[model samples]
Target chain A: MELIVPILAAAVRSGTPILYATLGEIMTEKSGVLNLGLEGIMLIGAYVGFIVTYNTGSPFWGLVAAFFVGMAVNVVHAFLCISLKANQVICGLAMTMFGTGVSSLLGRGYVGETIAGLQAVALPGLSSFPVVGPVFFSQDVMVYISYLLVFVVWFLMYKTKFGLMIRAVGDSPLSAEAAGISVSAVRYASTLLGGGLVSLGGAYLTVVYSHMWVDLMTAGRGWIAVALVIFAIWNPLRAALGSYLFGGVEALQMRIQAGGTTVPAPLLMMLPYILTIAVLVVISVFKGRGRMLGAPSALGLPFYREERE
Target chain B: MRIKVEKRFYITKWQEVCIILASIVLAFSSGALVFHFLGVDPLEAYKMMIDGSLGDFYGVSETVAKTIPLIMCSLAVALSFTMVVWNIGAEGQFVLGALACTAFVRYLYVDNFVVMLACMGISALLAGGLWGAFAGFLKARWNVNEIITTLMMNYVAILLLQYFVYGSWRDPTSLGFPMTPLFPKSARLHQFFSTRVHSGIFFAVIIALILWIVVRKGVWGYEIRVSGQNPKAADYAGIRSTRNVILVMFLSGAIAGLAGMAEMAGLHRRLQPGFAVGYGYTAIIIAWLARLHPLAIIFVSFLFGALFVGGENLQIAMRLPLSSVQILQGLILFFLLGGEFFRNYRVSFISRKR
Candidate 1:
């Protein structure tokens, strides 16, 4: 039970960042803009969040700072892809390279520094419940917030007028523009919101999870979140579930390694990556029709308002 | 109140080329400014960069050696990206190809150098092509996003390398380091001169020239460009867009795979973690900066190779941080991308009403 609790605990903690990033990416994709800078944005968030927490000795401030930095990064992406209507993939990749390099250079001094991270905030009576309680209710505020964001995102995407506009723009920007909706505005807002959420995910890792600032500490999690968005078929709730499963695998690998199983550490490290590829392959096999998963029709295409010719 | 927008002019063909060149210069200037901010003399840095890349015959040779893989990978990326097929897993394909080609050279019972080189090249090409084809298949058949699939596969490929180097392929004589056993003398690529330049540079240039020729003259290339420009029109005209997507991806991946073989056979002589470095990732930048033109990729790849070699020299001689090169590269990319805005769209000022 002790081992099981720690494993579950690790799963939740490990999965939170991926959940955050995937949710953010899902929002952007829904608005017909693919933000490839999740890796860069998250790195900036992790570095800035760690620096702020280290200086302030408070994780909350770190989260706030990281969110703002993430928003700033997204705004740049929005300006390029939405406003300027440049190529989305190139812009995103450049953003990643720039973001990673800047963050690493700025974070060179804080390599091994530690900060006081958040602790589990379980409900009073609920904390004493069986496995179910520990697995779900007893967790960090970020994890709860992720759950809330899932429902909120789902509701906003499917229920609200803003959601409708977002969907309309994503499906057909030309038609949306003709219908009097501002495609650029919708795209810009979604991209910013997406960037903010992904940065919070980064903050969760540096301030609430690992509590240290290290160069490229987010490693490949940002990329994995991109994969998860596809695996979940752009559904926020499914994305959260996929992230938890990924976290569970990561948690299991750590446990196996700690138990001194015959498997080598390098091989164990490779397991999650391999699993990600496998899941992608399986998803491809099961994905009968392209539109069934609700992928945006004009995801990566740049919209040109004046190019009628 | 309705706002009257002025008519925007389309950038002329000549202006497009000029803007690209201007952006390149601006990118370099931006790089110099970054150096100035780091307390280094910008002029001295520029001189150092140029001199380091071509100061002596040896330096030129080293640049050539680095340029080989960059050229190959950039060509790979440029070819696929031109067809709207993003093969982000080129890095993984490169690793897997290197691993396969190296294994062939080491364990195979081939005595002839010609046969060994042929085997290695073919294996690398096949491996890379398969990796790309897998992504293309997923994209074409299931409508899965190739970007996510390709990117995820890169990690898996890296892990595969880690597994082999640390596990079954560990060099028995090296005691503890994670790497494969060195290939036999016969399997190694021939060096050109006193410096470490190899035959692989010739191969890269040849491949680039071949791609240029193919795209310029071949029926398939014409179909690809047409389909890429307008898939719906191609579909209406009875061209198989899916087939072109798969074929372009294969060709792209094959070039990157050859890059892996070049690293293993020409330079490294064995597989290691640092075998190819960031050549695959850097190639993405190179391809874009070149605008996915085969001829342009050839030149840009050499430029990047010079930057890499020169950056190392700057680090050793000028006491600048190694990451200075990356910062410079980033600045160039930023401005280059920003410059594209001017090419496609014009910023006009409207007088504000009081």
Candidate 2:
């Protein structure tokens, strides 16, 4: 009971960035595009966001800058995969490498710099409550925005016409085109929107969580978010649940280390990745057994209208 | 006017050469733009990079030393890529191989130089092969995506290596630093002609020759190619894809493992955290650029070796970050992939419909 509150609060705090990335990826995958460049985009965003916030002393402008930069970088991916009909997987890997290089080069001067991070806001009446208030209501404004964004994404994915069109294109681009939907246009829009959100996730890491910039600081969270999309089975609400669960594990690992557990630090660090592999294998097994794996049907395939037989 | 992209039946060799040249040119131009942003003279930077990597004997030897591991890893990636196995776990396999070699050298205490080296090499091969084959088994049995599995395994492998180095394997003499004791002189690889370039180059050459023959002419190679290009047809022809996937991945991993062994025995002579810095990932680009041909991989590895050396030079000489090389590598790959589109399809402009 004593340890529970802090762990829960930490979980929500740690999970925000992952939630952003996962939701953004869900949006992209729903449009039949798989952007494995999330790690790179997040890195670039972290750098750009930190730089902007460091210079302007405003986190909001930093986030806006990150969003635009992410979209701009993703435009290259969109062009390669959609217009040039390059292999999606290869293009994504290239984007990641490119982003890493670009960010590291640009971020050299800003290393070790610090900024005023987003402060937690305690709701007046809600703060007086037990675990729920402290964990949910006493978070930064960005965290609340994340909560609101979750519902917005859920609404956009399930309760809107545009959402239906995104799914239609993902299910079958040919059929969607026949149904009068512009497949390429929809893909471009979703990819860009997803890019912006992913960038925001990176910004959240720099401006809200770390409050300092480091090269490759997002670590493998972007990859975890990618894996989380599959684990969530492509549902927005499940993505939230999955992100929080991962966040909880991360927080618990830190606490265990701080508490000086006998387990090796390296082994403790390996937990999330090992869990990711285990979950991936289990999901694949279910999929192999003819379960309804919620992957977009045309996920990584480039849509070429005239070439289809 | 509107553009129409139509698939081409075949790309002529001349056109292929032109596309390759264009990709190289475009990549350089973009790199130049980046240099200009950094306030460096693009042409001077390029000249310095080229001269630094090739002008001096010391530079040439360093490049060769770098090329030894790169060629082996590139060959490893090329083998699996040929079979479409997607064994992106080379990084993990390489680390495991190094761990295996360190364990052998530390425990066995073999006296004969030749025998000790052979044992270390065998241990690396087996460890890496098993690590890679684990992912292959998952893919074969459960239809799992190898990309994510392999990638996740990299972190696990690195962490496991760190655990050993930081804990039980820490050299008592090194006072708090996380590293293993240096190997005995007999256990270390022999350098050639008074340079840091080791016998690993000979090993790379021999392995490349063997892989080239196996991939280009062997019956198993034919099966791998058939299965990768058309799985249904291969299945109808009675080829076991699952077995092929596992076998190819194991071999691929074993080869990459040799790179780890080379790095330890030839370069570092001890296990440390930064022993293999992204060599495995760099090999992926080399494999793709070489089109999975063993000979081409050798040539591409040398070019990448030069880039690595030059990247270091840039850091020391021009005050540019080492990541500039990574940026160049990324641009080259991006342009190459984009250029592949033109190789397959020809774009034509048509008047827009009113």
Task: Supply fnat for every model shown.
Answer: 0.48, 0.79
**What TM value does the first chain of each candidate achieve?**
0.96, 0.96
The model with the greatest DockQ is 2
* Tens-digit lDDT string for candidate 2 (B311-331): 888988988888888889889
TM-score to native of every candidate shown: 0.92, 0.97
Over B1-354, each residue of candidate 1 has an lDDT whose tens digit, in order, gives 334333446768798888788887887887677667656788988798889998888778888889899999999988888777888878988997898897787678388889999999999999988888888887777666788778877877788788888888888988899888888877889987556888898889899899888876788778888887888888998999887788888888888898999889999898888775678888998998888888888788888999888988887888665566766766677667777877766666666776
Tens-digit lDDT string for candidate 1 (A1-309): 977987987897899999999999999988999888888889889988898989988888989999988988888789878766778888888778777767776777677889887878996786678986888779888888888999999999999999999888998899999999999999999999999999888888889888888777887888889888888988998998899899999999989988988887777887777778778878877877455458889898778877553
Give lDDT: candidate 2, residue A240: 91
Model 2 chain B is weakest, by summed lDDT over 10 consecutive residues, at: B274-283
| Docking outcome class, model 2 | medium
lDDT of 1: 0.83
User: Which stretch of 10 consecutive residues in model 1 chain B shows the poorest summed lDDT?
Assistant: B1-10
Q: Scored by Cα lDDT, where does model 2 land?
A: 0.88
Report how closely model 2 matches the true complex, as a DockQ value.
Answer: 0.76
